[model samples]
Target: MTLKTAQNIAKQFTLVKAAATTLLALALSATVMMQAASGASRVKDIADFEGIRENILVGYGLVVGLNGTGDSLNNSPFTEQSLEAMLERLGVNTRDTDLKTDNVAAVVVTATLPAFARQGTKVDVTISSIGDAESLLGGTLVVTPLMAADGEVYAVAQGSITVAGFAAGGEAASITKGVPTAGRIANGAIVERELGFDLATLTSLRISLRNPDLTTSRRIAKAINDFIGNRVAKSTDPSTVVLNLDGSKRDDMVDLLTDIEQLMVEPDQIARVVIDEQSGIIVIGKDVKVDTVAIAQGNLTVRITETPQVSQPSPFAEQGQTVVVPRTDIQVTEDGDKKLTVLNSGVRLQELVDGLNALGIGPRDMISILQAIKAAGALQAEIELM
Candidate 1:
């Protein structure tokens, strides 16, 4: 062959090789992305701190200062009792005399002590009338001991409740906003006792999942195991992830939490449909994918259009009084279009949202769709209506 033809053939061979290499690279990249997506589970996305939880503290106290709207002196005997008790504590002994009060309300004060609350720290308290009180506005709570479930006093709540609502006027007419029977006392309760558990006491740490799943738990265990040489984390249950701690491994628990929280373990969660009936709020998770199924969305529209027609007695009638003739009309429109989203592979949350949005449905409609999906065995999460 001629040298020139040989050169041309060599160049063609080089071009073909480059093309093949480019195709192979694209396939490899796509495969890696698919593998990563498959590894992502719903369990590892959210976490619940182990050994760290909120404690509910509650107390009973008297609310003073209401203009006849407080508990009835005759009906609510507890109010009188509370008043008498308060007076007795103040060195005034009138226990034998019958007492009536219209300026007091027996109320239950509640507060949540957040984890890591220190001694003497103040937290807000919620005051709700426990008696036949009309309003708790402008009432001062006397010294009340806030106790935990164990019956140990954790704090003392005392302050005038800042009721956001109020009732005014007599029996016939009254104006009120927010909630008159309930109010919040900002920073009213002082923490007296700290939590009993000492997290720093040489022991093993735990990584808890807010929503637990076996696949997610196993993935988390593997991720942590891979992050470090030792198997520091283990799944005791779907909700619990235990981490063995060595005193020499970490110094500050706070720092350790910071690290663990940032550790990106894809979470796994049971497929669930959650709905807030009052608010019409619905949320679908990314893992909420469906098997091969068909869904139909429809809209039923009721239109009531008023065509006001004024009628006058016949042109030559004596009264010729003009009157409005009610021409109320009603029509219903149905959506004959049905769009379906084929969730062949695992779909992400954004995709699910987009699919639902394409249905051209409202909050209530979406809620119905979710319910139907769950019923049809297409939706893979728990459905909870709140």
Candidate 2:
């Protein structure tokens, strides 16, 4: 072969090899992305349907039949009055009766009325002592009407209190387990009136994200629209995704919604660091990063000690007295084992934590260091003080 022809053939082979390598890289990248998307979560796990929420119902009730653990009638006049009124309603006249008893306690009953609850459906209720009742164990809660915020009766609660704890001892000292003044009754309250909300009659639905994020909202909208094979879902804001339901039959709405809810989508999260000052807890998100920064941590300790010495006159000379002489000593110490640490840019959450832990930094000290780094513009994530 001629020299010029050989060079030309080698050049062509190099170009072909490079193109093949690029295609392989692109194929690997696409496969990795598909694997990542497959690990996404279902829409129902991260978002809630608007207008479908529980309503809180509260009521004032009385618990009776305690074993000397009830509220004192003298100290809790409301308990006595409630018992008297209950007796009167039961056809027993207590107009001139002086009720004095420690077998009853005034309690506040609270329960959550779930959405779409029909009449006669039973729900759980929590009983908490409003008076100074030692325990609610083995007590039966009287029939009390639970009311909503609008002052309308929604349900009635009456059942034996199931206290998870107990208090027992003589007047000396008592040891209690769990919470003695609170209890719960499973399936305690029966629904007397529905909240009057029908999901089937709605023309459109709104999906509210639990943690608002613009990227997450868009992903949710796309997931729903793709599932239904139409442009039915639109992200209105970072927190809300609106679904257009016009021209859809009522029976189809349920099936469509079920499909939309089951669609899996990847949700985006904000890079953040949460620290609890009181509990010394630090939560660092996986996406949190820190820029290249140098850190120097050293502890300075100052200690002041006082010594009292007694001065006495020898042989008790005339007008001589004993006095206390105070001596003070101050000492300052700086830890010399600390060294300057240089963290690289784009430091991952685990790397940053490991670097800080290498310096024997506790959560309290780490909090201060993180704040300083954020102030210096080295920390690239939001710091949430909790």
Candidate 3:
């Protein structure tokens, strides 16, 4: 072949290869865009398996080792009584004497016991002062038995308190950051008892959605059923999906739950607009729609000026007297620059925002306008006031 023909063939091959690569990249991009538009999320992110939850435990405790910042025993009689009781427990009888301790504070200790927590596992605890304590900055929490709602002691918490705030003051003023009366202790409690729950022995399970929606619940059940290749999952309501473990091929319920939780499904939500009147915050959902409506916003302002003048009698006449006279001026004005803006029917969130922006109104005014629109039966979405 001629050299020129050979070069032309090579150049053609290079162009063809570049075109193929561009086509492949475009195909991948389209696939990614489609997946993103589907809005699929893992089942674990949207639903929780039944019988798997945390339990709250609370207890009354005492915090000591404070530098004169603890509760005043004179003002807080419970503190004084508690000090005497604790001393009596330790073989030192203080019931006959007045307990004047400023380094002891009564506190409420709280902690959450996680599901399936072992006896030796540790959890964090929060200590909050229940009395007039100035600070818990350098205090240590005493041993406290944390109890669950069943009135049974579940865990024991004790550690040095970690206060995130501090207080400083002279005679005149004081400055405090965060909450000086509350503190946290990391990994301060050890579980003493295990909850009576057996996951492997359960024959059925219920999956509860974080946000209740019929479509989303059905989608989750369908995803679980399709993954197991059986009719094991069913949606009974908008908030719950039941799973029959007997029909499942897997014998281990743990493995079955692990597999089901990893499956991805798209969740659905209703169209609603959330408005916070206090903060002037407005949130428009993606599915929110609006009917055709005309919106106009304006404010009328009135200004008044007052000036007082003293009038003197003509050139000190015998019977003349000085008197005070009042002059007033008033001006009334209306917003003429604001005009009515019309929104088309079936307008989406973006179009609605654009139309509202065209009216040149602040969020406060827009809040009122949204309420007015809802009252007029023009907004298609539910209005939620916060």
Stretches of candidate 1 above 4 Å error? 1-45, 226-228, 251-255, 276-280, 291-382
- Tell me how far the alpha carbon of residue 46 in candidate 1 is from the true structure, in angstroms, after superposition: 3.0
Candidate 2, residues 1-386, lDDT tens digits: the string is 99999999999999999999999999978966884666677789889997778999999999989988899988998898898899889998887777767789999999999988999999999999999989999999999899999999999999999998888888888788999999999999999999876676677889999999999999999877666677888999999999878643335556667777877788889999999999999999988898999998999999999998999998958878899999999999998998888889999988998889878878899999999999999999999998
TM-scores, all candidates, are 0.70, 0.83, 0.87
lDDT of 1 by residue, 165-257 (tens): 877767788677778999898999999999867776636777777666787777777776665567777888887778776532766666556
Candidate of highest lDDT: 3
| Model 2: worst 10 consecutive residues (lDDT sum) | 247-256
Best by TM-score: 3
Q: Let me know the TM-score candidate 1 reaches against the reference structure.
A: 0.70
Error of 1 at 217 (Å): 2.8
- The whole-model lDDT of each prediction reads 0.79, 0.89, 0.93
